[model samples]
Target: MVHRKHNRVDGKGRIVIPVKIRQAMGIEPGSMIEFDYMARRHQLVIRAVTETDQRAHNRET
Candidate 1:
């Protein structure tokens, strides 16, 4: 499924995720999301993060 939404970033660089997208992704108030920025495409990508993802990221660093 595709969820499309647009929201303004606050002065602190925080953007509000849409309720529909949140619900679909099972995101709670404190859920962690991963963000990837593609400078060439000028787009930002976001995805829900899991414990396994955290472990792999830690290993990489």
Candidate 2:
């Protein structure tokens, strides 16, 4: 269980994920992240890594 500190978006609309969490999640510099809004709940999300990520995982494994 990897625990991380949370950071809120600043007035300039920037949020920083902690370095440890970013490393654990495999987020890299210049990587593009997509966001989605759930139609039912009307909640926003940063999409989780998907099948392509699975392929990458397989390669590493």
lDDT (Cα, tens digit) per residue for candidate 1, span 1-61? 9888778999999989899999999888888898899999999888899878889999999
Per TM-score, the best of the predicted structures is 1
Q: For model 2, what is the error of residue 11's alpha carbon versus the real structure, in angstroms, after optimal superposition? A: 1.3
**lDDT of model 1 at residue 48?**
96
Mark the regions of model 2 whose C-alpha exceeds 4 Å error after superposition. Answer: 37-44, 48-61
Per-model TM-score versus the true fold: 0.79, 0.53
How many clashes in each candidate? 0, 0
lDDT tens digits by residue: candidate 2, 1-61: 7554768999999988677766766777765566798999998666446668768877999
